[model samples]
Each structure stands twice: as structure tokens, then as C-alpha cells.
Target chain A: MPKQMSRHSTVLKSPRRQAGKPRPHSGEPTHGPLTAEELQLAVRNHSMPLEALRKDTTPPGLHYVLTHFDIPFIDTDHWHLQIGGAVQRSLELSFRALLRAPSITIPVTLECAGNGRSLLRPRPLSQPWVLEAVGTAVWTGVPLAYLLTQAGVEDDAVEVLFSGVDTGVQGGVRQQFARSLPIEEALRPDVVLAYRMNGAELPPQHGYPLRLVVPGWYGMASVKWLSSIKVLTRPYDGFQQAVAYRYQEDADDAGTPVTWMKVRSLMVPPGVPDFFSRSRILPPGPVLLTGRAWSGQGAVQRVDVGIDGKWAPAHLEHPPAPFAWCAWSMPWVADPGEHEVSCRATDASGAVQPLEPVWNYQGMGNNVVQRIKVTVGQ
Target chain B: MPKQMSRHSTVLKSPRRQAGKPRPHSGEPTHGPLTAEELQLAVRNHSMPLEALRKDTTPPGLHYVLTHFDIPFIDTDHWHLQIGGAVQRSLELSFRALLRAPSITIPVTLECAGNGRSLLRPRPLSQPWVLEAVGTAVWTGVPLAYLLTQAGVEDDAVEVLFSGVDTGVQGGVRQQFARSLPIEEALRPDVVLAYRMNGAELPPQHGYPLRLVVPGWYGMASVKWLSSIKVLTRPYDGFQQAVAYRYQEDADDAGTPVTWMKVRSLMVPPGVPDFFSRSRILPPGPVLLTGRAWSGQGAVQRVDVGIDGKWAPAHLEHPPAPFAWCAWSMPWVADPGEHEVSCRATDASGAVQPLEPVWNYQGMGNNVVQRIKVTVGQ
Candidate 1:
């Protein structure tokens, strides 16, 4: 009498496959089977695949998920996060009023409103996401200026709005996706609201019950399925703070004045080894030449790493947290086939990393200069 | 004897449901039921589900597909396209010289390069894409300034590149995506190279043996699996023109710009008879609100529509051909219950549509002011 377990046919599966092969879950496995150094640190896209560590920390099922619409639950006793337009006390909060306030943590990295759009030169309509998007995590919460000074804001406010319980269908309209920040960067003091991650409690796909960890920027300005903020003395026409998070022409001309531009990234710079080009050539000894450096603005002073164009001083490693991401490495000595290795960085405010940036019809602030092309042999 | 031929396994199946309620393909198509004029366009994702005489003009397989790194197949005598750096006549051609040049067709619409990041707001990682990304077609080819004047671009070039034969593994960077445009939007003239599409001949998931068709922008500038192009005097730092079609900070900074902004859209403001928070109440008199009006920049020319905020006047049509999409409409007069119904447009260079627009980071060009909500009774 114990053999009646029939519930495995929920139906609907057509992800399509036989029209030229390759399409079963289109590269399936949203998790599992990694390790080649955990697939090069979960090759970005929400980061944390480095083999589910435990001490160097990173396991929350390998943190780094970043979603928006799909994963939305919200009934934590009728959820709340409100805040209110232009402020002067329009509060709301609850998730136990932001877990009883005064909290903190850090270690950021988010990225992806499209990440390396499969190297778009003219290919932009979308999706080709070259870098899996990106990730890092740690997080925690509270601070949004201690709840925007317990909702006091006003003084010609300027914009804060966040809103989310996720709902979509844009273009055909039916929106609800929202965003907005500048109330002095939402009263910074390390702007947060996150409900903890990496140390636990905030997992129903990374925005569990609350979110808004804006440290530097990118990661679509960190807003996840949050709920509401509003403060604006102007600038809040919703539908994602007025026509879905904007950007306008000029990386080469779609026109300009679309605004929002600054704080660029994409690094590699260090010493330049693995076949550093002049057309490749490497075969004499030890090498490493690693990469990765980030920023929304400030902190990252000096990274260099060149090869057939000079410079290679090296020596930096402060980032384990603080909007996280620093990893440098640079040790060389070779000489056989073909090369080119370049890298660059300089932020702390000085900003450098351009061989050509500033073109905006939406190729938004691309740091530039980071080439590679190894070949070396015996 | 023809009955002995039964080999349909081809694998794909699965859309049949009933046991646990997993249905969601609601792109509706019933038939074993429904007959009040087939329940009026049977609405769901394209709407109509009631009205009359819309005689299915391109609604069969439900149009709009868009793929990208998938769908390859080349070999048109080794495919080809090339073009070359700094130019002065480098050319490559093949695919029978891109089907013997001089073509034109028109029709346009393409979309998807992450079309409206699943309606952002705070949910911005990406790909929940409900508008299935748009389509229209009619393509054909040539132009791109006659292949940059048959690859003779010099005069201090200023970027062009394209290269595609698609490759993958982005973050660990096996790389190959490629993109670039600059040189006056790659010699505009509505940019081309397409190889045909609504007039057939392309579909290997669209991009068959050649592709490019830029038209106005977005569609990742239109590159598909094309091969090469190069030209540059400036922009083309690769990685999709420097870290994937970007967008960034500023817009007063609540933050979003991962890249590409401005030229918003979304005014599906017609006959909305449903959806309310501020508008809809029609049905007992005369109606017609209809929607859709585009503009990555230029060409919409008047769409207006309103109800409670009062305005009306709409009417735009004519765009099923060049760069496609125009469609507006307006005629309200029922007035009963809820009502807020908005819609704005104006283009042909006068710009307009902005009850609010200036937040950027990566919700690329989201035209604002589009509302809808309905409820009328006796």
C-alpha cells in the first residue's frame, strides 16, 4: 500500500532542441559541475563558483545570483519598505523595521545590466552577455543613511524612489520597475538596506524580503525586488524612474545629453607575462599575469602591467571588501612566439583607463585598454 | 503503402498539460473550443481577444524570434564579408557577393539587446524579456555605405569593425563576439548587409549566411554571425565596444547605466479597456486608444492620447516598411469609473514624450509617459 507517489508530470517543457542540436537547457546546469579553479571564479555572472569554499568564504550556494522580476515573494507579514517622497517623515520599513536598524557589512560587486554585451561593436539589440554578468556579495544592510534619517529628507529633496515587488512587460508597457538615487546618493554612509547575504537570511534568490545595496554603482544601481523609497523634489516619473533606467547616444552618436556617465572599469594590468605581444613570444621561465580590477568611482590607485609598450611596476592588494574586487598579479620572463598583453588602471579619483571612452549612445563609460594574445613555446 | 512511413521522433515535444497546472504557453491557440468569432483574436500577449475583423495579418506563428550566439551554419563557399582597417578598398564579399548587391526591402523592427531589461525599476540583471523582443522583418541588404565604399574608408577612418562567425565562453574569455560602428554610423543610408528576412532566405535562426542590417540602432547595431569589417580611426576597443554595450552613473545617480541610454518608447495607449490605477472605463459608447510608437531617436511624430489628464488627438500609422513601427490611434468617450490613461509621443525631431526621463546606468532609452487602466459600469 506504500506505492502511490505520482506527482512528476507538471507538463510544459518545450525549451526546444532538435533543429541543429545544441539546446537542451541551452547549456543547462544553473549550478554544479564547475572546478577548473571553479571555472575561473564562476567566470563573473554573480560570482562565487570558486568551488563552494567554506573558509575563504563564499558558500550560500555560491552566492552571486542577481535577478529582478521572476523571484518575488513578499508577504513577510505584509511586507514594507516605503520611505516616501521628498520626506520629512513618511517612513514605513518593517521587515521588523529593517531588522531593528544600525547594521552593516560590505564586500560588493554586482554588475550586469548587460555586462560585456557579447562585445557589441554594432551587435547591440541584446543578450550575448560575454561575462556571465558578475558577482561578489557579503552585503548585510540598514544604513540608507540610517533610514534616510528616519525619513526626514526634504530641502528640495532631488530623487530617491526605488520600488520593486517585481512586475514586468516593458515596451508593450505594464511596468513597475523603478529606480532613483541622488538624495546625496541616498544619504550615503555606505548606502544599504540589504537583508544580509553570505552570512545568511536573504536568499530566495538574493533579494529575499528586501534589497538596495548601492555601493559604487553598476548592478543596475542595486534595487532588486525591493519595495519603495520615493523622496524626489522632482525626477521620479516612475516606469523605472522615467523611461526605464536611461542612457543616450554618443559612444559614437545616437545623439547625447542622455546623462549618467562616469566611473569606468575593466582591468588586467600588472606585470605582463604569458606571451605579452609584439606578436607573441614566450619561453624562458616563470609567469602568471593575472587580472581584474573594478570601481564605480575612486579607490584602485595604480595597476599598470604592460609589455612591448613598457611599464610594469606592480604591488597592490587592499580590496577584500569595500564594494569588493581587486585581485592583481604580474610576474613575467619569456621569449618564443607571439605577444601583446596590456593593462591599465589608476582610480582613486585620477581615473585613467582609456584608449578611447566617452562615446555614449549607450556604450556607457567603458574603461578601455586591457588587451591580451599569448603564444609562447620552447 | 504510405502508412509504413512513421518516423516522427525528432524529439522536441512536451507542451501537453493536465496534471499539476504548469500551463504558461498562453500565447493562446485553442480551437477544440471557443467560437464567438474565435473569441476575438484570443488575446494573451498580443491582445484583441474580443473585438472583430482583424483578419490575422501576420499573427500565425506569432512572429518575433531573435536568437544571437546560436544559429550559425556558414559555408556559402566559405561565407566571407571582411572590409578591413583604415580602408581604401579592402573588400571581401562572397556569399555570392552578398547576393549580388543592390537590394533594399525595408520593413525593420528587430529589438532585443536585452529589450527593456525585464522592465527594470530595480529588477535589472536581465532576460525575463516578455515582448519576446519584437520583429517585423522584410530586410534585404547592401547599403552600409556600399560596403564602406567597397572598403575604402580612409580619411582618418574612425571605427567600423564587425567580425562574427560567433564563438563563445565569455568570462573565461575564449571570445569572438565583436562589434563596432562609429564611422558616421557605418555610413548610414539606413545601414544594411542583411541578406533577406521577411522575404525569406535568411533564417538559420535569422542571420543564415550573412547579417548586419543596423537600421536606426539597437539589435546590438545588427551584426549576427557576420564575419569581419574593421576600419577604425578611433572607437572599437572591442569587448562589444568596451565592456558590452554600456551605460552608467549620473542622471542624478540612483545609478543604472551599464551603457546606452536615451530615446525612450512605450505608449501602448489604445483601447486599453482594462488595467487601472488611473484609467480604462470605456465600453458603453465609443472607444479606440490602441498603442505602440517608437524612437531610438527621431520619427514618431505625434501620438498624444489621454483621458482624465485630458489631451486626445492621436493617429500616426504608416511604418510597416522603412525601419517599421508607428501605429498609434485615439478616440475615447465612454467615461464611467476609473480613468488616468496617458500616452505621449511627438518625434519627427520635435522630441516630446517626457513626463520624466533622465535616469541612466543601463535601462537603455526607455521613452516615458505611458499609462493605462480601465473600469466602466452601469
Candidate 2:
């Protein structure tokens, strides 16, 4: 027998801990401090390393991934995407059949709705993400609109619900991961049912055989591990759709649903990084600073690079596609001192990253400006 | 502008924390608790979920990854692996040339030296991993001995240093990631310079174009993003070699070098899991309990299933390869009650997992038995 296991220093001291009592999941926020449960979630679900911001389309493995439940393994041969509900004709398409359909490839950036949650003053007690919960990839698939038109949606259908094979208990409800999109949004030509990511078969972590690629929306809207689609005559209110991924001010508020991503930008930490602190240290010289920025509303109209607290407009390049992130750069002759480097993006619709993090019940849509600490040596 | 920023509950409360101080990294034990810096590393480098144990070969994305610095991107067309130092013939092999060399495919189980670091009474102030830092994969590559023999090693050569392109600062010293092996271990037939994993090009996070795969050794022995190899007449004392990854009793002790993984076993957590606690729930019935057991010293000899601390012998199967993990199973008839399910492994070398975690300065090799909490519902 292992000598009585006992060592959770933080959990023992935390006033919020219930100690052995299994609590049901809820939308309540932790008043202060991160918990052991949140730490477990943070380590299980990871964020993209900001260093990867150097690439255009994030290499598949480096792309950020989030699964509400465990990744469900799919045998391509045995998989069939069933499409039914209010449609005039139900359809079941195999992996090969979907690949043979009209294929279109495009670069799309996906950001998790809870990206900067850790940056919030009262950290959410879920995945305590600190930026980096975003990535861009080239996806190849059939236009979701094409499939919907083929099925001939009935006139009364108001929304389309997507159900993923991955299942788990959340808020005491055991159900498949499911979410819905209004009829108009589901009919967008660029919305895709993707089978491939960055020219490779979708990796299991990113939802193997098939998944929905909702361009311009936060990652939660782009469900993974696709199993079925149902055209609903009434609005869908599943656990994921109604109980989470919302912009709530308090527990009593039926917060507005989180949809398109807010404007955001991230800089590659400059110079050599410390193994633990990740603080940058480099000899003084002319250094090129670069990063990626984007928004779900539209193209990024401008990006500003800030040194310390002063801001300067940076050179921005057009993206490969309307929904993809754009590259931005600025040259700086760094002085010998400690400094903070940050970047902020403003989309065509004028949405910009908040200079400081905003607190919310579930900690969603926290597109706060990124700040990296660095030291320039002689 | 958003607002003034503030929050770090644990960092602020811990008496050991030095606010705003840029301290040099060291092997000093963090005698009491995990730190904010360790939490940062924990989330960046993830572990495989316990549920993934159900599979034979872990899916690539689910494989554990630990990068001390950044993942360097390699261009396959231009990359050449340089081989030099105490050798009669120096060689530089291109990616294409190496691919055409004699190939061998083998399944290897790799576990991190610090897999159970967080379990220590006083946690090591680095990536605070639990018991999930392990995975088995089928790797295809050219035999390392075949390449070493072709290059012709000199009689006086004592060790071989492997250099990876990833560069970072550790203990305030900046250098590329490097490690070495004794001449005898370097000439093993199964040691390989791998190019493919699970029949596909190694993903970027796992070291894209090329990497060294030393089967049966800890993952640190298999350098990722490998670029150069140098045969040495004397021991190499790089930071990674001399300072990190040592099994030290205290800072002053010239600790034994950490090498092969210790014996360990983990069960695939059965039934539905609570999203936060991960406590299991299942209907009462006859259930088959299964998991994987592996050791670098040799094959796993025995696996014992422990129900509420009572031990029972389990059925074991031969592994796919000598270096791969072996499967073990036991049948359990559950009643309507709560229980703690655990498993313990003993390797061919007669080394068995410790019942309780042993504390160390660097928190290396703490392979204590694994336990899971479950509830059998009516």
C-alpha cells in the first residue's frame, strides 16, 4: 500500500474547496484564486504556444484543441454522417462519399470563446486559459449549404442542430456534445463539413473523420466528432447551447449566446525564453517583432504594436482568405532595460481587444491585449 | 484602455515566492508547494488522458509531449543531419538519403523522467505532471547502429551527444537542447533515427523531419527536432546533461543520472466521468477492468488489480514488441457502493511501483501506484 497519499498544498488551503464532496457542474464563477480542479482541466486541454504564431497556417499538431469529453475514435469505414429531422429526404453519407463531393479548401482561424479567462481578475473555475487558445488551419470539405440544399429543408425549420459522438456528464446531464445554428447562419456558403485539416486527415484530437467548420465563429460553434445533423422546427436548447458558452453578467441573467469571435492579436515572445518564467532575454539590437491578428466579424483593418505602454501602428499584410488571420510586424531598436511588448487588433467592424481583462460569470470572450515581459542586455 | 490588472492568489499568499525577482533556475527543492511558474509549464506541456489507455498504440495527438524550449520548424528539403566528432568518417545525411537507408519498424513505450513530479510531498518547481506522461507508438526508421558503423567510430570515443535545434535559457545559461549516451547504449540495434510515426511523417510537435528514438529509455533520451550528432572522447556536461534531470537527494549531492523509466501501471478509468472531479459512475454489473503496464528495464512481469486496497492477480498479454507496453485485465463484479480501484506493476528486473511517492530534489522517478475513485450506481 502506498504510504497514505496526501499532497495538494493549494487545495488544502483554498477556502472554496468542499473536500471529497462531489459537486454538480454549474455556471457559477469562483470568487478568486484558481483551483486544483481547474488546474486539472488546464493541463488536460492545452493552448497553442505563442511561438507558433510565426507560421501562417498553424501546423496541424500545433493547432489549439479543446474537447468537452474524451476524443472519440472514429473508424472511417464504419462512419456515416446521418442528416435527418425536418428535411424532406434523410441522407447518410460515408467518409469516401463526402470526399467525392464538391470540395473547397480555405484557411480559417478559430478562437476559443474562453481564451483569456485566466487573465480575468476572478479566474473562471474551468479551463484556466491565458491567451494562446486559438489557431488557424486550411480545411478541405463540402459546402454545408450544398448538403442542406440537397436534403431539401422543410419551410418550418428554424435552426440546424449538430451532434458529436463524444459524450460526457456536464451540469449532471449525460449527453452527446450538441449545438445549433440559426437557419440563416447554417446556409452560409463558406460554412463547411470538413474531413481534412492542413491537407491531412483530421487528427482524432481535432475531431477525426468529420466535423463542422463554422468560419469566423469562436471554436465552440465549430463542433468536433460529427455524428448526426438535425433540422429543428423549434430553437435547440441542449446543455451546450443554453447552459454554457454565453456572455453572462451574473448567475440570474440568461446571457446572450457567444457567437462570432471578438478582435484579438498575439505576439511571438521575442528573444530566448527562460525555461520557467518564459520571460525573454536578448542582446540589444534591431529586432523584428511579428504576430497574427484576426476577428470573426470581418478583416482586420489595423494592428498597433506597443512597447511598454506607448502604441505605434505596425505594418499589416492581407490574409490568404477573408476568415484567416493576417500577419503584422514592426522593427524596434531595443534599449537595455526591462520592457513589456503587446499588440492589439481592430477589425473592419471596429471591434478591438480590451487593454485589460473583463470579468464575467463564465469568463467567455476575453479578448484582452497580450503583454510579454522581456529584458534587453548589453 | 480597459482597467488596472491584478490577481495571483497562490503566488501572493505563498511565503516562498519572491515577487518581481528574476532568479536563476536551480535544482533547489521547493519544499512545500507547486508554484505559478510550474502551473504555466504544466498547461503548455500536456499529458495523455487516462481513457486513452484503452488503445494499443496511442493516437499520435494523444501522445505526451514535453518541450523545454520551443518546437523548431524544420524544412525537409534543406535539412541535413550532421554526424561528426571522434569518428574516422564524418557524415551529413539528408532527409531523403536517410529515408532510403535500411528501415526497421518497432513499437516503443516512452515515459518522462518527471512523470510523477507533482505527486512528491514537496513538488518540484517545474512541469508538475501527474501519472499521465506516457504513450506507446509504432516508429519506423533506420537503425542507429547501422549509421554509426557506417560512419566508423574511433576506439577512444566514450559518448555521443545529440543536439536539437530548440534553444532556450536554463539556470541563466543559453544553449540548444542536448543530451548524450554512453558508447555501449549508442550501439544498440533497436536505437533508431526515426522519420515516421504510425506510418506518417513525424508531426511538428513530435519533431517533424527527424528525431532520435531510443527505445526502452526515458523520453528525454529520444531528442526531438534533432539536427546534429557528435561522438565524444569525454563525458558531455551541458546544462541539460549536468544540471537537469538528475535524481538528487539535495542540492549539494552529485546525484545519480536519471535513465530508464521505473515500473508503473495505469488503468483506463471505467464508466461515465464527472467533468471536473473525473470521479467515475457506472451501473452495477460485471465489468472488465483493463490497462497498460510497461518498464524500460524489461518486460512487465506481473500486474495486480487492487479493489479497495485488496490485491488480486490480473491476466497479462504479450506486448507487440519487447519495448512496447503490455496489456493486463481483470473481471470485477461491482455492487452498489463507492470504491477505489488501483493497479501495480512489477517489471522483469523485479522493480515494482512504490506504494507512496518518494520525495527528491528534482522530483525524478516517482512512479507510485495509480488509484481511481468510482461509484457503482443502482
Candidate 3:
């Protein structure tokens, strides 16, 4: 997620509030500038509900959606992906051509780097996000590496830039949503220019016609509504690349750019009451604890549950797909009283989640441990 | 934490089980090899209770304790720290003399590298630790850097090894418990040869006479029962250094050694019921979500709460100290229903807690997101 820009006062006025203007995209209620009330409603309605997250596969309608502005209006009949800049051949490939290309399908979890930004103290004052900025889906598309090869990337190319059709004023500058990755990362076999999500043609909210799927990276790197691919000899200094998605230590430091999704795990809510509520009560008995754990760096090796404060081993179910999260559970004998429960996961790369997050200006990768409280009664 | 070795058959018989044998450490019932019954009692009595974690400062008695072997009996009156190996001057400084040296006090959280080991799959078959292997204390000690400088470290010195008096057979090898750190890390300002913990002389279970506190690194790197410091021109290949504290990717790769504490967070149970129990039932009302967030890399910038997958910004409290965790809370309006709640934290360095932990052979640094379940009723 890019750092939100200064709000343009003129654009804050919703099109609906201006007059009897029809919504920008027919059939898509969430496609135009939203009134304050509509914005809140949109956030509530568009978020991937916890109920939907309990299943192994995320249904398309339940997919988490995050966009900087309105979803771009794209006509599939006229859409084309332009490949230029440090490439020997500049080519414009229509949607049909992309569909005809050899395609591969892989499951990947795309998380917004700014997923927890709204929770930060002295908050960023923009994009008040909660954790619903993440989702996993099976994406089917041609490898971007293959497309780059077809365009014949020049020898001096150092970075690959992806630009989307969505444009707005951010950080006091008008620009398209653009980001760049090192050539090495951009050329990974799993990097794709996707047109299908979860076996269906891309939904309008998910960048219909085309989008970049830079697996393992934060969603910002996977530019939605991707329109152009540019091979660059120098690192791209576009707004998103140089300023917005960067993790700055302070005003003085040249920040590190957000990249791969950190290792994380989330449990499917066991049938229970609001965990943070004071009125939570329960009857002591045996209970099963379960959740899903995954990592962008490698496979999950183990997951342990900390019941109260005692740690116990958990049983891990094999992942459905290579990059999918592993399901884990542990049975606990509950005693009547208040209890705090939490779990930790270790990954193949030896990286474990931290008890706390490393703070950055952008609030990019907050993967801190999660805890919940519950009450029990006879 | 080093891997456990084959147990000596002769030592398996607990003195208590042998009948009428006096306890090894008078007044401390937890000393020596424990009988099955004693093991259960010790686990019940000695583990840090979760309620104690709710405060800003952890009381010494409430601090968590973990050890690989019996606590060594060290006479503070006769104890001395031996500094030798690749140093120009070899010196043995008595406890009093060491205390006379310049001392600084700093708060540091020490977490056992194997703190969550038992939680891993294929259970480690060793110390089955559940999460109570971590605590924070204010340590006062002369800087190890000062002593190393006085000892005149050799130009070629590459590593500094710390040896502890507590020793038993581990990994089938009989040797003193020892670990080494790179010269650069050893020379850090926070590395200390400590004689005090929380303003008092170190406790018996906490390496009483002397210990090394390597803040920021896992507790394993901070050798307890400190006896000697050895500077080495070559990398130290002690059992703990070469074979145990390392995180192996697979049987084929030379695993990376565990180092700094990863980012993580945990909430103090907010007066609730046993979360995992099936019989949990509650009356809906407002609930307060609260917890402490900290990081070894930097300060925590944010902590967000996820209520049934819907996210909300949390209000954060000022940290009591720079190294201490920042307190945070979110007011939640509970609706009658089953719900799961969780939280994530971001640090000043931009590192976020992972939803899951990266897996490793050593099961070190498992920092995964945590969740709990509860039921609300009318």
C-alpha cells in the first residue's frame, strides 16, 4: 500500500451527491467516489467477513478488496498491455492474446502492506485500514517473465516497472499508480500478469482485464488494472516506488521498500462470543484450538499454542497447495476462569513471528503476535 | 537453547524417588532431577502465571525461569570471572571487584530460544517447553566491552565465547554449557557481564554470582551461571554454537544460527473466560482489548485488533521505558454471537509480526499471530 496522499478537496465531493449522475460503473455500487457514509458502508460491505475466511478456499465475492481510488473503467474489447522501455521490441498485446498465451495457476496470498496502518499511533491520517486488506486466491495467468522475454528485455535493464490505469492526486502530485521491482525479483518464475482469479475472469474490483501478481510481495507490487510493463535501466522513482510503499525509519533515513509478505497465522474463529468483551463467559471443558499458518519465505515447520501461559505442541495438517497455509490444532482441557490464548509459528527459513512488530513510518509489515481473552463458568 | 542429549540412565532416578534422600538445594523444592509427580507440581508452581504479565514491570518472583540442567551451586564469596583466550592479558576478577567496575542498568527482555519448542510438529522429543520461558528485568553490570578492552583483545580475534558453570551431558557430549558471539556483536554497548537483576543480586535460578546479558538476542545467547569468557581467533565451534543453537533448513544445509529476538506481541488476558472451551457463553456488552507490544529491533508503532475478521484501530498508551512494551487497547461493542479476536503489531523498524512463524529445525523464534474464541448471549 502506498502512503496516502493529501486529499484533494474537489474530489471528496461524491458524484452521487453532486447531482442525479449515474454511478460510474454500472452494476458496481462501489465504483465511484463515496460519500463519508458510503465510504464506511463500502468498507463494511466489501471486507472479507470472518465467516468467509473459515473455509479453505476464499470465494470471489468474499475476497478482500483494496483500491487507492475508484476501480478503473476498462473495456475488455479495447484493453491491451503495452510493453516498452528498455526492451528490444515494444509490443501491444490485446486481452485475447494474453488469454491465448500459455498459462499457469498458483495460489497466493496477497496482503496490503498497510493492512494495520489505521492502528498506528499518530496514525498516517490516510487510508484508515483494518486487517481486511489481505486475501488468498488461486490466480491463473501467463508468467510475466515469459512476457518480458518475449519483449526481449535489454541487457542493461535493472528494474521492471508496472503501471496501472488508476490515476489520482496523491502526495500533492497527480500520477498513475505505478511501482517497480528489481529485475531479479520481477523475473521470478511465479511472477504473473494475471487475468483470472479463483477460476473466474477477474472481477472489476480486482482489476478486470489484467493485473500483476508478484507472488510473495505485498499487494502494492502487484499493480491492479495493470496497463503497461516498462523495463528500466535505472530504479523507477515513481511515487509508489520511491515514497509511498517505502518503510522509512524517520524523516532522515532513505527507507527500505516494502516487499515480501512476512510469515503470519490466523485461527478460524472457534464458535464463541466476542473475545474482547467483558461479558464473555464459558463452562469449563475440553476445547480444540485451530488456525492456519503460512510464510512467504518458506514452509511452516511448526505451530504451538500458549494456553494461559503454558506452551503446548499442536497437530499440523498438510497444506492443500505448496504456498497455502498449513492448518494446525491442539486440544486443551479448560478450567473455569479467565484465560489468555495465543500461538506462535516457526517457518522453514527459521524466521518466527515476533512478540512485537518493528515500527516503521509506513506501518508496512506489522506481524506481531495476536492474543484474545475469554471467560469460563461452571 | 541447545538440543538435549541422551540422558544418563544412572541420573534418571530422582533422589525423591529413591526415598529419604535429602533435597539437593534446601528451601528450593524444584532443584535436581524431578519425579513424575514433582515434575507436574513444579510445572504448576514455577511457571509464570499469565495474570502477572499484565503489569508494566515484571516482579522478580513472578519472572519466568527455564534451565537445561540443575542450577549450579556457586559461592559468590569465592566466585570469579575468568577472561582469557585471545586476549593479551588474562585476568580473574572476583565478584566484589567486578561490582566495583563501572556499571550501567538497562531493561531487557530475555526469551528462551526454545521457549516455544514443544509447540512444533514432530515434537522435539526434548524439553517440552510451553510459552512461560520468557521475562524482562533491569540488569546492572559492567560492560563486557569495557572488560574486553582492558584485557586487550587480539587483532585477529573473531569471536568471544561465554562459558557457564551449569553443565550436563547434552547431545551425547559432556561439556560445560557455552556459546559464542561474533566480536562485533559482543562489543555492543548493551552486552554486559552482570551481577544484578532487577536491582538485587541475581537470583539462584538466574545465574546468581555472574551472567552475561546479550540484549536483543535470544535468551540462549545470554549465558547464565557465567564462569569464563574466552576470545577466539577462529569461530567458536562449541556444542551450543556449532550444533545446537543453529536453525537448519534441512538435513543437507548448514543451518543458520539463531540470533536477535524476532518481532512479537501478546495481550494480557482482559478478564475473560477460557477461550478454547466449547461451553463458553457470554452476555453481550462493551469489551476492552488490551496488550503490550515491543520489539528488539525498534519501538512498536502500532497494534490493531481484529474482531471477527473486522479490524479497528486501537488506542495506544505511552511506553514506560524505551525498551519496554507500549500498552494498547480498543473499545469493542459486543453483539450476541460467536466471535474470534486477535491483534497485530508493527515496530519502528518496519518489521511487522507475521501471521505465522518461519519454521526451523531448532524451533527458535516462533512469533505467530494469536487468536481466541468466545460466545456472547442475551
For A246-349, candidate 1 gives per-residue lDDT tens digits of 34332222121112222333332222121101122335577766655656566677777777668785565777865666766678785765566676777666
Given the true complex, what DockQ would model 3 score? 0.01
Q: Across residues B1-378, which tens digit of lDDT does each residue of candidate 2 receive?
A: 001111111012212323433222444555554566776786678888777888898878778889888877789888899999999999999999998999999999999988888777666678878889999989999888898899999999999999999898887788899999888889999999899999989988898788899887789999999899999999998878777876666554455567777778999888877676677888899999999999877579999999999999899999999889999999999889999999999987767887888677777777899999999988
**Residue-level error in angstroms, candidate 2, position A226:** 1.5
Ranking by TM-score: 2, 3, 1
* Candidate 3 to native Cα RMSD, angstroms: 27.2
Q: Which whole-number lDDT from 0 to 100 does residue A347 have in model 3?
A: 76
- Which prediction has the highest TM-score against the true structure? 2
Q: Whose lDDT is higher: candidate 2's or candidate 3's?
A: 2
Positional deviation of residue A168's Cα in model 3 after best superposition, in angstroms: 0.8
TM-score of 2: 0.92
Q: Which of 2 and 3 is the better model by DockQ? A: 2
Candidate 2, residues A70-119, lDDT tens digits: the string is: 77778988899999999999999988899899989989999888888877
Q: Identify the CAPRI category of the predicted complex in candidate 3.
A: incorrect
- Interface RMSD for all numbered candidates: 21.9, 2.0, 24.9
